[model samples]
Target: MSSTFSLKYMSRRVSCAFNLLQVCLVVAVLALLVTASPLFAENALNGAENTAEAETEAGVAAAEVIQAPALAAIAPAPAADEPLSPRMRAALGYVAQRYRVSADALRPIFHAVQSTSQELSLDPLLIVAVIGVESRFNPFSQSVMGAQGLMQVIPRFHKDKLPANAGKAPLLDPVTNVRVGSLALEEAIRRNGGLMEGLQQFAGATRDEDQTYATKVLSEKQRLEDAANRRLGRG
Candidate 1:
């Protein structure tokens, strides 16, 4: 009886030891799985965050590209018939007032001056100065010294130098006078080497004449420009 009891007790002890070993193995595997699961979850979260940031950057880039062409297309280009400079407009107004004529009346004269000046390589300001000094822009003016029209061109000079149309017309016609005056100014510039020098040399005999003449004509130009500015409500 004693021998049988010993064998049974030994077998029960061995069974308990085997069950403890099995429990220890299962605990170790559970710990390893817990640690690795956290690493996997962190990697997935990081990937999702990187994807969201990339998408945001792409959206901003797309918005900028879409807006660029729209802004450029909506912008207005400058017009071909932009208004004249303030000084030029003022000069026109002064001529109109002094001549007792409408601003429209002087447009043709202004155009003629511009055209002729370009053709002759002369300054339109110099021609304007000569007209102001010679006849105060009065196309009907005649001098006792035989100087006639806006630039006070001598009839003899016109007959000798000008074309037949110039000789046949009355010296007081504004277009004819301006045409003749422009030609004379071109000749003067050629003879004296420049517009300012020609004016100085030609007006040498009169009182403080060259500077005075330039100042007066420039002043007239300014006045005309100022008047035009007022008319246009441009200040």
Candidate 2:
């Protein structure tokens, strides 16, 4: 009986040891699975973060490219035409106001001056200066010396140079005055060689000192230009 009891006790001790060993092995395997799961989760999160960063950078690049073309399209273009002449533009305004007419009313006179000046190879400003001085753009102005129209043309001179009945009509008619004045100015320019000498020639015998007449006419031209600038609010 004692021997049988010892054998049974030994067998029971062996069975308990084996069960404990099995529990320890299962615990070790569960610990390994938990640690490896965390590593895999961290790697997946890092990959997702990298992908999101790349997408954000791509969006910023796309925005820059889109805005580049849009900004270029909206940019202002440069002006491509010539600017107007201040002197000529101011002269036109003066002519409009002094004549009490619209700018269009003097288009013919402007064209005549331009055409005649070109044909005579004269400065249009010189012609305008003479017109401003002689009559203040008044077509019918007559001098005490019987000089008629804007040019203060002498009737006898017109008879010699112009067609018949040239001086019989009203002296202040703008078209007739411009025609006669242009012709006389052309003749004066021919005799004098250039604008300066022609101006001197036009002033001859008109004043006690020849330079005095030229000075007066030039001064008048300046006044007209000033008046025009004032009206245009450029003064």
Candidate 3:
């Protein structure tokens, strides 16, 4: 039997066995990072009004994506007509506030995730969570393991999967990075036969029996869910 280990939405599932306490710890660290930079809150507030319009345009700005495969899908993407759902909007806001980036600037990233969701059956929140765990939203981040861009994908391992026209340093491009990373994530889950193992493979930590990397990714995802629910009055 093939192990179908997709990282489905945690809010609705009884699987994965994610540790909420660990999630809370990550959130606390995130909070401390924001607190250390008070201007982040101020910047988020100042950019609030612009978010609506920018987000509208941002949805239109998200480039196209190619699919490697869908990992049994994740969070439901809102209706095609309403790409930016309340949950998605809430997620964008939280990321902007936490990362000290303007909401207007994050619109494109959300849009990209949304677009990818439509194709690859992954949730924007999950992708957002992975990005946080991988690189804290830093498009230029490069791990000591040779992972690069916001998704921390190792280019050498996935150059063939990249867009043909993507020039040198393609992984550094946020849009391209997200697209390839999502595909890579799907492939990993599909190959590993389950979410836990897939995430372990993605993190290059298959031997970690405690599943720390998967736990961290899920924790970040839970945080996104909480933020979305709170913003949507569904908490």
lDDT of each: 0.69, 0.70, 0.82
Per residue, candidate 3 scores C-alpha lDDT tens digits across 21-60 of 6788899999999787778777787688589779877766
lDDT of 3 at 18: 56
Which TM-score value belongs to model 2?
0.49
Best by lDDT: 3
Per-model TM-score on C-alpha atoms: 0.50, 0.49, 0.64
Per-residue C-alpha lDDT of model 2 across residues 148-168, encoded as one tens digit per residue? 766777766655556565545
* Model 2: worst 10 consecutive residues (lDDT sum): 75-84
Model 1, residue 63: displacement in angstroms? Answer: 72
Locate the minimum summed-lDDT window of 10 residues in model 3: 63-72
Q: What is the lDDT of residue 117 in candidate 2?
A: 67
TM-score pick, better of 2 and 3: 3
> Which ranges of candidate 2 are over 4 A from the true structure?
1-90, 98-102, 164-167, 170-172, 206-210, 220-235
Ranking, lDDT, top scorer first:
3, 2, 1
Candidate 3 segments exceeding 4 Å error: 1-82
The local distance difference test score of model 3 is 0.82
lDDT (Cα, tens digit) per residue for candidate 1, span 113-156: 66676678765656766777777767788878777888787777
True-structure lDDT of candidate 2: 0.70
